[model samples]
Every structure is written in structure tokens, then in C-alpha cells.
Target chain A: MAWDLSSDRPIFIQIIERIQMDIVSGKYNAGEKLPSVRELAAEAAVNPNTMQKALSELERTGLVYTQRTSGRYITEDEAMIAGLREKLAREKVTEFLESMKRLNYQPDEIVPMITEREETQ
Target chain B: MTSLLECRNLTKRYENKTALSDINLDLTAGHIVGLLGPNGSGKTTLIKLINGLLYPTEGSVRVKGHEIGVESKRVVSYLPDHMFLNDNRKIKYILSYFSDFFEDFDSAKAYEMLGRLGIDSEAKLRTLSKGTKEKVHLILAMSRRAELYVLDEPIAGVDPAARDYILNTILTGYNEQATILISTHLITDIENILDEVIFLQHGQIRLHATVDEIRQREGKSVDTLFREVFRC
Candidate 1:
């Protein structure tokens, strides 16, 4: 998939978000080796330094870790991955709710609407 | 930690006008720096000074602690704003010339890039399309193992696919110990691939900061900030 980065936010932060989504969604398995910074940069069409910055931020959050001589890998902490999934899902749900509220949908109307769509599908 | 390029109060003046004024800048190794400005904003002058193609009216530019001289020229792989080479020759001929000229030129790499672009080695530069010529220049410049790569508007008027190719070539040509200085007004296309951006306005440095820093502090991309700063 194309790296869908918007211009108004920090590019590296977007990179971080993309990588995290990949990890939590099982696109990258736990303990899997991540691509080198250069490769990642090319894949994202971004500078390596920006990729480096994002990888470092991921490291700080304990989602990714470096192995020095070997390179970086996705964290083996499955709980951390699950936790991040929850956080991201909540953010998306909140966004959906806000947009629905803007459209004059009551808070009580969203779940049944979702279920009705689910049944129709 | 090594300073790849440094300028101290670097100024260039024409007969009655200043093109670049009192510019002090330092760039260390391992950066893709964007030199951005409007027309007549001295981006070209600053690049020329770095490559020793033009002399400064005052102040100095230093590359790896040496002044702009033969040593600096040897390490700075420059692609001028216009075609500097004679376009009457074949791709292979210029490839050989570059190999024989620059000590760091990688002929194999150049050939690979040309082949990837489906550009025939036997084709004359004059016979190629404008986009192909630009790609050839970018391939040749990037094929060098130089200390600095100074590309002046490499993607100014290219098509979208060509732009992607150029940026991908640049990204894959990563060198942790060398710096790439690219000058262009096309900010949105390149802002993602740049480490730092230097904004020049009215012949002076208006801002110099990392790309993410600009995004964090200003809450917008470099291109948006540039539009706000240099808007008519």
C-alpha cells in the first residue's frame, strides 16, 4: 500500500503511526526483523534520517528494539501490541463518533446503525 | 560530527545588486538539505559558491575545512541549474568522461541507472527527451561517491513518475557520511525526503531547521510554511 502521509502533520510522526499500525495489525509479526533504515526510507519515499527518527521513537515506546550487530526487530511484547491496538481502535471510534455527532446522529444511534450495516453486509 | 560544508558571512554582489548577503551556514555530514527560495533569491549563487564555480565578493565557503578550490571541487558532485555538458555526445561517451575525470565516479552504477530507465547508452544526449536528460544527469551525479552532492533544481519541471524515480534514486543512494544539498522551489514534492531545509528570502537566510522540527513547531509541512512566508 502507498504511504498515505498528509502534509499538515509531522512526517516522522506519521511514519511512526504507520509502522505501529503494521505491527499491531499483525502485518509484522512479533519478534520479526524490521527492514533497515535505508530500505524503510525508500519504501516510504522519505529520507533515512526521518526514518531513523521514527524508528528511534518506536524504540522509546518499546514497540521496536535494536539488536546492535543484528539490526532492529518488532517487540516480542504481545501485550504491548494488544494495548496499542486498543488505543488506536479507541481513537478511531472516537473520531467516528465525533463525525456522526456533527451529522446530528445521537450517541445511542451509532451502535445499532453499525449492527444494521453489519447485518446487511 | 564532521562539518561537511560551512559558510561564514558568505556574500556575493553583482555590479549594483547583492545576490547573496551575509549568509552564515553550517552543514555536517549525513543530511539531505533543501535549499529553497524564490527567483533571484540567491539559491543558485550559494550553490555556485559551494562548487567554486563563482567567487564570493566577500566572506568564504569551506568544504570539509578546505576553501573552495581543487580539493573542494573534487569532493562536490554538482549538477548545475542548466545543462553544463555538451549535449552532442552519446550517453556512453559522457559516462566514460566522468569515469576518467572524477576519481570517485562509479561507471557501473551510472550504467545500471541508465539501463533501468531504458535509456540507450548509444543514444546522443541531444536525441533524448528532456525528462530522460534530467534523469541521466541525476544518475550521473548520484553515481559519484563524493563527499557532497549539490543538485540544483533536479526536479523542477519533470513529470510525476520522473520525480518519483529521482527521489527514489536519491533515497537509495544513501551515504551516512556524505551530505546532499538540493536547491529547488518545488517544496511539497521533496519535503518528505529532506532532513533539513534552509529557506532563503531576499538574498538572506530566513530559516534553517530540520523538516520534522518545522512540522512540530509550525504545525504544518515545509511547503505550507513556505507558501505563508513567500506568498505574493
Candidate 2:
């Protein structure tokens, strides 16, 4: 996942979002060992402290686990991963629908197109 | 569960004037605390007391459940505002000294970080630029996995770009379980990163609270409050 340093949002939050995207894109497979804090900081050109903050947030959200003296690993629970994916997907759909409504698009005009796209997928 | 640093009604007097009076502090682990104060407010004095470099005329100072002494010195890592490393020694030699003194020094990590900065270990300390020298000092302080890190003015006088680098090093390099106490007047730059703050004014702790709690209660950033509280 790409980490952009110039974003106005906090760096730690951006790091968390990038990791979430990686999970969604399968860049980090279940139970895969993530990079160490120092490695990630070097890779991203961010402070090691910022990287630690991101990792701490991921741990808080149950997306990663630390094995003492070993390292942090991606959660292997497929159900948990799927649950997060579905939750994010729902949020996106809700946002899209809200945008359409604001643009004066009726449910009859947009829902069928969405349904057709899902059917094709 | 023992406190890393403690003070009880600590007081210090300088030349017939009180620098600090009745200042009590109890700090625990897993906290990156900010010690905020204006000039001559005694923030430095308080830290000196904790590091065993200065003795309080009244009350007491303790580290790791023992009064300030040799054992406390062993567990506490201090980075004073001024340069402490010998100007003639090579960076690698200093690293060796640190390793010998602190049993928990992570040599591999330290070397890896220096490599990232493109810093060679053989260079003499006196030959390096000021910013580079500051980084070297910070690297040494952070390489040790000490129980408490007392950094005084860690980034006060560096260039903006280098300032970010130094702050990042501290953030990423230190052990998460250890307590870090940073004393500085640059509250805005570090306000976002702190777990809590101990606002010092006229040699006393005026406010101490979690970052979130402070924002909630004051409806303002700690920097804003600091300016208002210490406004002339």
C-alpha cells in the first residue's frame, strides 16, 4: 500500500487506512508477518514513533496481534476479515447512494444500474 | 507496578529566589509526557532532580522505587539540552560505551538506523554538523531500552527539517513500555503525540491530563491553553 506523507490527516490514521487497504487487496495474507516498526518507518520515510502508533491502532482494532519477542502478524480469521470488508463496502454504498440522492437521482434510476453491475461481477 | 519517577513537595532555591516550590509528581510507565513551562519556570530543575544531577533542598526525588543514586542512574536515560558526548570520540566507540553500560542496548537496531541516515560510525563527533551531532546524541539515548527516558529540550534549536527527523527518531526508536518525559516550550509541535501533559508554570504543575481529556474539558488544544495560561 502507498503511504502519502503530505496528507492533512494525521500520519498514524493514514498508516492504519493503508494497512486496511492492504488487507482488502490481499497484499497481507492471513497470519502473514508484517514489517517491523523500524522497517516500516524506513520504507515510508516516517518517524518510527508514527509507525508504532499505527501498529498500536491496528492492535486496538483486532486486525493484528503481537507475539512477544517474535513480531506482529496479520489476523488469520477469515470471518473477521470478511466482516470488516463487508462493513467498509456498506459504508461506501451508503455514501454513493447519498451522493446520488443529493444529485436528484431517483432510486429507480440508480438501483437498477448498481444491481446490474453486481450481477455482472 | 512501581513508579519510575516520583517527587514529594520538591523545592529548589536559586540565589535567594525560589525556582520551584512544593512541586509533587508521580509518573508511571507507557506515557510520553510533556513538561510544559515558560522560561525560568524550573522545568529543567525538576528534570535535573529526577536524573540525580541536582539535589532538591526540600522534599525528595526517587527513581524506580529507590531514592536518587547509582541504581536509579543505571535505569534512567537522560538527554540534556546541551551536547554530552565527547567531541573527540568516534560514533562507533560511543556506541560501544553505551552497549557496555546499558545491558539492554539494541546494537543491531542502532546500526540499522544509522545506515538509514547514511551516517558512518567511524566519523569523529567534533567533525559532524550540529544537526548531525544532535541526531547522534538522540540515537544514543534511544538505542538504550531504558525504563525511563528524560529528554530535556530534545528538539528546541534544530532546523525545521531536522527537527522532524529527531522527533521521529524518538517516536519510533524507544520501547513502548518505557516512560518518556520531554521538557520543552515547543508545545504545539508535540501536542498531538503526547499521551498526557504536565503543564508547569512558575515551578509548579498546573495541569496534568490525558490529551483527549484536555481537549474535551478545555475545548481547545493544549497549545492554545499553554499560550493563554502563560500569556504575559
Candidate 3:
């Protein structure tokens, strides 16, 4: 759910990312019940309405589903999970590569060293 | 769900000047809303109206689906910008008085919070520093599990560190069933925590929206937009 980051970024985007991370990290399993809006808001130290906005967005992306009386739950679709993981991994790789470029280290310089460290381990 | 609080075309005017005008708003349960405005912008007057301390010159305010009166007062716990507690009373005694009046008052929660703030229950309000006095007032406001919590500038008198503590206390102590309305000019600090923000200027609501909507529509931080709109 959303958190009061007090940062320049809009909180709803961060909320979407947080729920995605929870799914990828296995903190919530497919078809499992998600926390109620009020409960998640309290845990995140945010307003309940803000938390609701985030959950509604997750539902739009097919990552979560809502039942009339039963509340929200994680989507059971395996493809949704795969998409989330792929998106996150791509973001991490882009950030890592950008950092390397700034440091003036090419792939040849960085990858060989990483492989060497891996072999030593 | 029905609105827990609503102000319909609310207007408040002094002999020659308007304090608030044509205001219409609604507040539901389980939201922490930011009530923001500059000095003399009627933030204090709005809080007073909501608390039934001041009467609206025109229109009406409903608390929990009824007009602001004795019944409405029972459901609302208000912390005014200025001190309301008797200066001569001990902090502990004042808290006890609050507990006696408000059915939802939690004395244990008040004590636990004061202990965290290093406040001595035995100390009289007159003996404490200004900052500590404000802290005590804040602790009282939040200790209640009221349906609606109306706090006016809860951190204005405290230092930055203490302000952070005050914000944290509000965040942690709130019950899921209650709605908190905080009125202050400190927009940047509270902007992140708000579900919706109502911006007042010249005693009128200029903007009201969810934080996400503001960022999406304006393409700027609330602080940045505030400066542009209200800048000298």
C-alpha cells in the first residue's frame, strides 16, 4: 500500500511498486487475501483513501481483484506475476548499467570482474 | 457510506468582513485530510465552526449526520491552535478531566505517549516550557478514540524534531474508525500524509483533490503549485 514518503514523487506510483514488490518477494501468494484498505493504511501510516487509490490501480493492472463482501485478493494469474518480475528486473538492470556508464566502466570491464568474483565464491 | 461531517454552503462573516464564504465540503471516516491556508485565511474560523465554538453566520454544519450542537460536540474531539487547558492545572489532572468528559478517552494511551515525550504527569501546565505545553495539548487531542479528530496547528509551537514526533504520534495513535482533520499552513511537511487536501484562500476553498490527482493534473508538487498560486 501507499506510504507517506514526503518525497517529490507522487505517492500512488510508489504504492503500486510496493505491492508489486510484495508479490514478487512472495510476501503475498497468488489468490491470497490482501489487507483491507483501513488496515493497510494504518500499517503504512497513510490515509485510507490514499491506500484505496493505490489498490484500485493494482486492480486495473490485473494484479489484484476485489470481491463485493470479501475484500481484495492477489490475482491468481501466473502471467501477471511473471510480468511484474520482468519489469522489476529490467528496471534494476537499467539502473545498474546507467551507474556503470557514469563510472566510465564498459560491459567488458564490469562483466568480467563480476564473473571473476562469482568464480572465486 | 454517509459523510461523518459535512459543511453545506457554510458562511461566516464578521461585522464588516467575511471569515469564510460559500463553503461546501464532506469528510468521511478513516481519512487524514490536510486543511491548509495562509494567515487570516479562515483556517482557525473553520476549525472553530466544526467544534461549535463559533456559529456560522449563514448555512449549516453537520457532524455525524446532524447539526453542530451538543450531540455533535460529543462525537468530535478538537484541539484548538491556542491552548484551551487551564494554565494552573497539572498535566495529569487535565488529562483526567478530559477522560471524565470524553467517553472514548484512553488514559493509558495518554500516559504512554507522555512517557515517550519525557513529560512528567505531576508538572503543572504553567511550569512547563512553551514547546512542552504544546506537546501536552497534542497528546490530549490524539489520546481520544473519537469519531472525528479536529486538530488546528498541532505542531506550530514545537521545534523540527518535536514536530516530527508530533506527526509520528498522530500517524501511530489513530484508530481505523476515526477521521482526522489537521489545519495548518505547513503544506510541504504534511502533504505526503494527506489523502485529500483542501486549499483555502481569501476565506474560500481554492483547490480540493486527492494528492495523486493534483500531481497528475498540475504536473507539479503541491508545494510548488502552492507557491505559484499564493506567492507574493
Candidate 4:
């Protein structure tokens, strides 16, 4: 996956978000081995130390685990993945609703608009 | 840990003009640092002093806790802004020259990078385009396992694609314990990869902070902050 990072934010935090998105999207399946820090750093075009810091953050969250003498692997917890997926969905929906309200759409009209857009899709 | 490069009350003057004045800074290991400023901001003068290409008029520069000299030169790999390679030499000859001059030079890694870039080893330096020459220089500089890599405008005067390639090479090539100090005015292109940034203005150090601190506290990118601070 292409690592699209903005310069306004901390790169390590962005790296963590990207990896989390990848895991939730099934780009990296649960229990699968993740790429080494160097490999990911090269792919992301970031400093290796930054990538290492991001991976350690993930390990702290229980989203990843490191095996001695081997490398890091994604968490095998299905519930955690589902929880993250829900959290992301809610955040995106909240953003959408906030924008809609700013455009003068009532909360009542927002649901129908979303339904209409969904049906058209 | 001791700093990899330290400048204490460093000053540089030529005749009546002062290029850098009473500057002091310390850079530790394992960081990709951006030395940022506008034209004639003393960036080059400071880098030249660190590389021992030019002597300071006052104070001193130290590498790995020692004064800048033969021992410091051995650990500091420098890539100047202009073309430092001989235009008459073949790429292979240049690689050989680097290997002979620097004990830390990795000829095999140089060949691998050359092959990856599709640059012919037998091609003369003058035969290649300007961008290709820059790439060759960068490859040579990064092939050294030095403790400090001082790159002067490595991404300047190149297309976006070439800039990306250069950044990637630097990211992958340096030793883990080494520090890279890159001098450039193009802040946004190199900002994401930099662990810390040092802002230079009028031969003085303005600010030195981690990338995260600037973004988190100021709520602006380095490029935006640079424009604000250096507005004409």
C-alpha cells in the first residue's frame, strides 16, 4: 500500500494510523507476519527509527506482538479488529454528519440524504 | 550519548564579511536532521566547516567528540552542492577512487545501487545528464559507512521522481548509529523524514526542535512555519 503522509502531522503517528487501517481492511490478516521495520521504512519512505517507534506503539496497544528471534505479527484477536472497524466507521460518520449540518441540513434530512446516496450507489 | 557533530562558538569570515557568526549546535546520532534556510543563509559555510573543507575563523567543530581533522574526516562523509566528481572519469573509476580513499566505502553496495538505477558503470560522468550525475554523487556518498553524513542540497535542482529516489537512498543506506545532516531550502519535501530540524537565518541558529513538537504546538507544517519566520 502507498503510504500517503501529510507533513503537518507527526510521521510516526501517521504510520501507526496507516498500519491500523491496513490491518482492519484485511490487507494484513490477523496472525500474519508483518514486514520488518527496515522493509516497511523503505516502503513508506520514512526513517527506520520512526517506523520502529510506530511498531512499538502498535505492540503496546495489543494490536501487534513481537516474537523473539523472529519479527512482529498482527494480533489474532478478532474482537479487537471488529472494535476498531466500528470505531473508524463511527468517526467517519460523525465527520459526515458535522459537514452536513454545516450545510444547513437538519438531522432529519441527513438520514434520507445518506439513504438516497446509498441507493444510487 | 555524545553528539556526533558539535559546533561551539563557530564563526566564519572572509575579509570584511561574516558568513557565520558565533554559532553553536549539537547533533546526536540516529537522526535525519534538516539544516534549513534561504539563499546565503550560511548553511553552506557551516557544512563546509564541518567537512573540514574550510577552516573557521574562530571557535571549532568537533566530530564524535574530537576536533575536525584527519580523524574527524575519516568519519564524516560529505556531498557538496556543486559537482565534486571529475567529469572525465568513468563511473567505475569514480567508485574505485572512493573505495581507495575511504576505508568505510562499500564498493559492492555502490555497484548494486548503480545497477538499480540503470546507470552504466562504463559511462563517463560528462556523458550523463545533470540528474544522473547527482544520483551518482549521492550513491557514492551514501555507500560510505561514516558516522556523520553531511549532504548539501541533495534534492535541489532535480525532478520530483529523482528527489524521491534520493530520499529513499538516504533512508535505506545510512548506518543505524550514523547521523545525516541535510541542508536544503525545500522543507516540505524532506520534512516527513526528518527527526529534527534546525532553522538557520542570517548565519544564526533560530530554532531546533523535533518534527512532532513543531506540528503539535504550532499547528503548522515546517514549510508554512519557515515561510512565516523568513518572510521578506
Candidate 5:
């Protein structure tokens, strides 16, 4: 997948978000072996050190684990992935709601607008 | 374990003009530093001083704790802004030439990159396009396992796609212990890979900070900050 990095935020944070999205979306399945830091950095067109930092942060959150010799792997906990998916969805929805509110749409109008947009699509 | 590069009271002068004045900087190992500035900002002068091509008028530059000389030259791989290779030579010949001159040059890696880029080893350099020639130059320079890689305008003339390839090549080629000091005005193109940046204005050091710090504090890219700081 293409990495769309903005200049406004720290790149390592973006790396974390991208990897988290991949894990939650099942692009990287639970218990599957993740690519090496160098491989991921090259793919993302970022520094390996930055990628390593991101992976370490993921490990801290229990989303990834490292084996001393073999390398890093995605967490085998299915519930953690589900939780992350829900969290990401909620954050996106909150953002959408805020934007709709700014557009002067009432909370009661949002559900109908969503259904109307989905049907038109 | 001295700093990878250190400059003390570094100043450069030619005749009556001062190119760089009273500069002090230290670059440690493992950093990909961006030496950024506009035209005649002494970016080239600083690079030339580090490469030992031009001596400083009143100061010193040390690489791995040694002054810029034979010892430092051995460890510093420099890619000057201008074309340094002979156009009459073929790609293979240039590879051999690099291998002969630089003890750290890895012929195998150079050949691998050439093949990956679909550059014929037997083709003469004169026949290649401008961008291809620059790629060849980059391949040769990065093939060296030097302690410090000083690149001047490595991405200047290339298209966006080629720029990405060039940046990736630099990123993957260097060893972890080595440091890369890339001097360029194309701040956005190189900003993502940079660990730190040193901005120069009017032959003086303007700012030096890590990329993350700048992004966090300024809420913008290096490109935007540079434009704001140096706006005419």
C-alpha cells in the first residue's frame, strides 16, 4: 500500500498509524510475521531508524512482538485487533460528525443523510 | 567515538569575499542531515571544506576526529555538484576506476545497482541522458562503504520518480554507523529521510534541529519553514 505521509506531523507517528490500520484491516493478520524494519522502511520510503521506532511503539501497545532472533510478529490477540478497529472507526466517525455539524447539519439529520448518500452511491 | 564531523570557527574566504563565517557544528554518526540554503549560502563552500577540496581560511573541519586530509578523505565519500566522471568512459570502466581509487568501493553492489536500473555496463557515459548520468554518479558514490557520505544536489535535476529512487538508494545503501550530509534546496523532497537539518543563510548557520522537533514545534514541513525564514 502507498504511504501518504503529510509534512505536518512526525513521520514515526504516521508509520504507527499506517501499521495499526494494516493490522486492524487484516492486511497483516494476527500472529503473522511482519516484514523486517528495513523492508518496511524501504517500502514506505522512510529511514529504517524511524521504522524501528514505530515498531517499538507498536510493541509497547501489545500490537506487535519481537522474537530475539527471528524478528517481529503481529500480536496473536484477536480482541486487541477488534478493539483497535473499533477505536479507529470511532475516531473517523467523530471527525465526520464534527465536519457535518460545521456544515450546519443537525445530529438528527445526519442518519438520514448517511442513508441517502449510501443509497445514491 | 568522536563526532562523525565537527567544524570549529569554520570560515571560508576567497580574495575579499567571505563565503562562510564563524560556523560551528557537530554531526554525529547515524544521522541523515540536510544542509539547506539558497544560492550562494555557503552550502557548497562548507561541503568543499569537508571534502578537503578547499581549505578554510581561518578554521578547521574534522572527520571522525581527524582533520580533513588523507585520513579523513579515506572515510569521506563526496559527490560534488558538478559531473566528476569522465564522459568517454563506459559504466564498467567507471566502476573499476572507483574501485581502484576508493578502498571502500564495493564493485559487486555497484554492478547490482546498475543491473537493477537497467543500465548497460558496456554503454559509454556520454551516451546516457542527464538524469541517467546523475543516477550513475549516485550509484558510484553510494556503492562506497564510507563513514560519511556528502552528497551535493543529488536530486536537483531528476524527475519526481527518479528523486524517489535516488532517496531510497541513499537510504538503503549506507551502513548504520555512517552519516549522510545531503546539501540541497529541495527541502520537501529530502525532508522525510532527514534526521536533522542545518539551515544556512548569508554564509551563517541559521538553524539546526531534528526533523521531528521542527515538525512538532512549527506545525509545518521544513520546506514551509525555509520559505518563511528566507523569504525575500
Candidate 6:
């Protein structure tokens, strides 16, 4: 799928977040070879330099690593991926809670509503 | 490390009206810079000055440390605002003409792109529709392995679907070391591909900053900012 990037934030940051989500969700498995920067950029409809920047940032975060000759790949560290998965889940929870609070829902009433929706489904 | 393009005190005046005034800018290698402005806002004038099509009134434009001359022209692949090719010639003839004219023009690449568009090489330019003609010209311009690509309104005339094709071609087929300078009013369509953007207004530069920097500092997209800044 094409990258649905928002314009208000930094595009590279969005790239990083998208890749992180993809990695944690197993779209890109651990130790899987990542596509070349040019390919990813073209798919995202972004500049190659910006894609390169996002990939380099991912390297820094230990989600992806470059092998010099063979090119970049997803990190093999399961612990890091698990940690990122938890972090993303928690961020989603925070967002959900904020939206509920804005709708005048009580903080203590959120968990029951979440459980009831899950049960109904 | 040297600037790919440098403009110093560049000003252009057409008799009674000043088009560009006292512009000092230097663009480094490898970045996609957008030259943006509304109608009659000196974007075209700046591009014309860079291409040596029109002489600047006050100052100069240098490419890779030399004045705009044969060497600079050799390195700057320019796509003017309008069609420059003779429509009577066959596409195959033009392909050979480009190969003969420019040392760096890639005949194979141009043909490959034309083939992708299903454009018949034996057909004359006059037979193609306006959109196809624009794409064909873009293919010709992009086929050159030049150091700096100066595209003036490359995406303006075409339809939305053609716009996507043009942007994809631009994003995919570019040399890493070569810088691209795109002048267009379609900000939202191109914001993601730009490293830096220069906003021109009333014959002057209103802003020149990285896309991320502008978004971070302004808390809005470049399109929104442009609308706000140039609002009537």
C-alpha cells in the first residue's frame, strides 16, 4: 500500500513511525531484508534522501541495521521489537483515553466500556 | 561540497516592472528544492535567469563555481514553461536529434519511457495529445544526465493522473549527486519530495527553509502556509 503520510508533521518522522509499526506488526519480520532506499522512497512517493534519512534514524533506534555491502535489514533483536510493540500499544491506549476524556467519559468508566465492547464483538 | 547553484544579488527588471529583486541563494548538491510562488511572482524569472534565457538586471548566477556559459549550460538540464520542440518532427527523429545534440542524453532511457507511455516512435509530435506532449517533453528533459535539473512548472498543465506519473518519474529517475530545482504552484502534490522550499512573493523571497523546518516551526503544511501568506 502507498504511504498515507500527513503533511503537518515531518515526513521522515512519519516514515520512521510507519516502518516501526510495520516491523512490530510483523509485516517486516526480524532479520528480514528491507527494500532498498530508492524502492521505498518511490513507493512512498518521497525523495530518496528523505527515505535515507528515515532509514538511518531507524538504524539509530535499533529497529533496522545496514550491512555496508548487502544493504539494510530489519533488526534481529526480538527484545527490541517486543518493546516497540508494547510502546505502540500504550500510545494507542493513551490516544483512545484522551479521546474518551474529551467526550466527557470518566477515567474509571473506560475499562468497563472497553471490556463490554470486546464482549459484544 | 561546493554549491551546485549559486545566485548572487540576482534581479530581473522588465522595463517598468521589477520581476526579481536582490536574491542571494546557494543550493547544494543532492537536495530537491522547490521554487514556489503565485502568478507573476518572479518564479519564472528566477528560473529563466538560472537557465541563461534572460540576463539578470543586477547580478549573476553561477553553476558549479562558473558563470552561466557553455559549461554551465552543459550541466543544467532545463525544461522551459512551454513546449520548445518542433511538432512536425517524428518522435524517432527527435530521439536521434537529442542523442546527437547532448553528450549526456540517454536515447535508450527516453525510448524506454516513451514505450511505457505507448507512444509510437514513428509518430510525429503533432499527433500526440497535450498531456502526452508534456510527458514526452519531461521524458526528454529527464533523460539527460545533468548536474542540475531546472524544471519550470513541470506538473502544472497536466491532469491529476498525469501528475502522479510525472511525480513518480521524478522521484524514481534521478541521480543522487545531482540536485533538482522544481518550480511549481502545486505545493501539496510535491511537499513530500522537497527537501527545501523557497517562497517568492512580490518580486522577493518571502521564505526559504527546509520542509520539516517549516512544518515544525509553523505547525502547518506548506500548502496551508502558502494559502495563509498569499491570501487576498
lDDT of 1 by residue, A1-121 (tens): 2377998888999999999999988999999999999999999999898999999999998999999899999999999999999999999999999999999999788889999999999
- Alpha carbon lDDT at B48, candidate 1: 92
Give the Å shift of residue A57 in candidate 3.
Answer: 3.7
TM-scores for candidates 1 onward, in order: 0.97, 0.70, 0.82, 0.95, 0.95, 0.97
TM-score for chain A in each prediction: 0.96, 0.84, 0.90, 0.95, 0.95, 0.96
Looking at model 2 chain A, report the run of 10 residues with the lowest lDDT sum: A1-10
Tell how far residue B131 is off in model 1, in angstroms. 2.2
Count of clashing residue pairs in every prediction: 0, 3, 0, 0, 0, 0
Best by DockQ: 1
Encode model 3's per-residue lDDT on B180-214: one tens digit a residue: 89988787777777878889999999998877778
Q: Across residues A1-121, which tens digit of lDDT does each residue of candidate 3 receive?
A: 3354645567778778888998999999999999887667667756566778889999998999999899999999978898889989999999999999999999889999889999999
Candidate 2 lDDT tens digits, B16-65: 98888998888898678999888988889998988888889899888877
Report the error of model 6 at residue B149, Å. Answer: 0.6
Clashes in model 3: which pairs?
none
Q: Order the candidates by DockQ, highest first — what do you get?
A: 1, 6, 4, 5, 3, 2
**Which DockQ values do the candidates obtain, in the order shown?**
0.89, 0.12, 0.38, 0.71, 0.70, 0.86
Q: What DockQ number belongs to candidate 4?
A: 0.71
Clashing pairs in 1: none
lDDT of 3 at A117: 94
Sort all candidates by lDDT, best to worst: 6, 1, 5, 4, 3, 2
Candidate 2: residue A66 lDDT (0-100) = 96
Show where candidate 5 strays beyond 4 Å: A118-121
RMSD of each: 1.3, 5.5, 4.0, 1.6, 1.7, 1.2
Error of 1 at B175 (Å): 1.6
Per-residue lDDT of A104 in model 5: 97
State, as a TM-score between 0 and 1, how close model 5 is to the true structure: 0.95
Q: What lDDT does the true structure give each of the candidates?
A: 0.91, 0.81, 0.86, 0.90, 0.90, 0.91
Error of 2 at A116 (Å): 22
Per-residue lDDT tens digits of candidate 5, residues B14-56? 9999999999999998879999999999999999999988999
